[model samples]
Target chain A: MTTTEAPAPSASVIARRLVSLHGLTRLVLFAGFWLVFAGNDPQSWIIGAPAVLLASWTAERLSRRRGRDVTLGGLLRYIPFFLWESILGGTDVAKRVMRPEVDIAPGLIEYKIRLTEPGARVFFLDSISLLPGTLSADYRDGIAYVHALDADEDLLDPLRRLELRVADLFGERLGGEPDA
Target chain B: MNILLDLLSVLLILAGAFFFIAGTVGLLRLPDLFTRLHALTKADNLGLGLIMLGCVRFAPDGLYIAKMLLLWLLIMASGATASHLIAKRALRGDGEDY
Candidate 1:
């Protein structure tokens, strides 16, 4: 639901920014990963530095979506929500399965995605499966097709809440609510 | 303090193991592929989360705790992505063997 878009940059300008900004960020992140695994060994850096560089280059080459700015505050807020929901999600499934009679009403539900960023949408899909009783099956034309363990329940409410959380995380404003 | 940490870790690990057992049983009892996946993700998310959290309780150093957390993050990402792919494939009727 983004409007009044900025004019697209020239290809060379885009490439320069991509390399200087995006590439540098990836380089630092990859180096951090290397350090976390390799520790402070000077001997390890002989190979680790080159390996980290290669990884950053490869990541830049393969990434399809432009990097989206994520707010650290938003991330801090989202983590607790994510952790609590996942725990509820886990126990929800576990309780259902542990009952004397195994009961599940499995079916698919299509959810309209409000977030504009492709990366955010992809995150939504990845996260839907981790929530209670919902597994994302596919996405097409701005709608996410999700497989629900209980199709009978009101699934849209939870999906909407999750979408709002994702939007907050990415600092994106969703299009105002459409008719449910 | 050490005894308390050890006791907490033991309880968490036991709870984690119970969830793993529940996930497996659900995977077997569920009627179809999608439901089975729903079951498996619980184990991937909560079961592993609990176990890693338990490990963190007695971690020897900051680096050790960070590594444990990183492992959990990696598994959760991979597990979620793979679950989506599998569900998509099944929906497409690509793998009819199920």
Candidate 2:
């Protein structure tokens, strides 16, 4: 019973900020990213809390519109696996960069989505770009266009694995048949 | 070993200070803000990194050092992110280069 919805003014911004806040893959590679961001000033949380107070609001709204809101517990479940992948991603980037023959086959790719939230979808796009050898070309209409340096199985494999990890966190399914 | 660590710390702090001063000067003298940010951010990031490295050297053990280094990473993330956000905003406002 879902219908095409009307756009709102703040939706534009919520959409963008959602992308910025949710994508942690890149920073995760950098090591304890948010904890570090919080470590430095100790005062950052002060400004950040209020600035981001609106985020929870927008996230809920996005979920209502799109049908998925990532609960804190669900999002946190993948942290360990995500950390391991970050280490592997760092090595992958180093190997590809150092190797002379490994020419990167970069191009846009469309990844299908199961989550209905536009914000959550954008989050997925940003996190994928954070990995080495892959950049997000774009995400539109529930499809993510991923650009990879090497368009081989490895690239797709990691994303597949990552999607599973995220799905496990959110209790959703990805790239499987619809039993309808 | 203790003496060596102290010397290392001194050298690192001095080197970091040098880089910071150079970056500050570049920020003051560069003709464009982007260029200024270029000099400032890169230098500041590495400068703080070295200073953190030096502090870690003098610390009691690796765990304490890791904690301190974690602090540096935090500063870096915020600094880099803020710089980018500010630069993007400035660029939109008819860009005040330098």
Best by TM-score: 1
Candidate 2: fraction of native contacts reproduced: 0.00
Candidate 2: residue pairs that collide: A36-B74, A104-A149, A105-A149, A106-A148, A109-A146, B32-B97, B32-B98, B33-B97, B33-B98
Model 2 / residue B20 / CA error / Å: 18
Ten-residue segment with the worst summed lDDT in candidate 1 chain A? A1-10
**Tens-digit per-residue lDDT, A1-180, candidate 1:** 112245555556545654786577768888888877987788999999889977865555555456576778889999999999889889989988889888788889888888888778888888898889899887777888899889999999899999999999999988956534
DockQ of 2: 0.06
Cα deviation of A160, candidate 1, in Å: 0.4
Task: Give the number of the best model, judged by lDDT.
Answer: 1
Provide the global lDDT of candidate 1 against the true structure.
0.83
Cα lDDT computed for each candidate against the true fold: 0.83, 0.54
Which CAPRI tier for candidate 1?
Answer: medium
Cα deviation at B46, candidate 2, in Å, is 15
For model 2, residues B14-98, the per-residue Cα lDDT tens digits are: 7677667756665665455444544455556556766777777667765566677677656655654454445545644645664
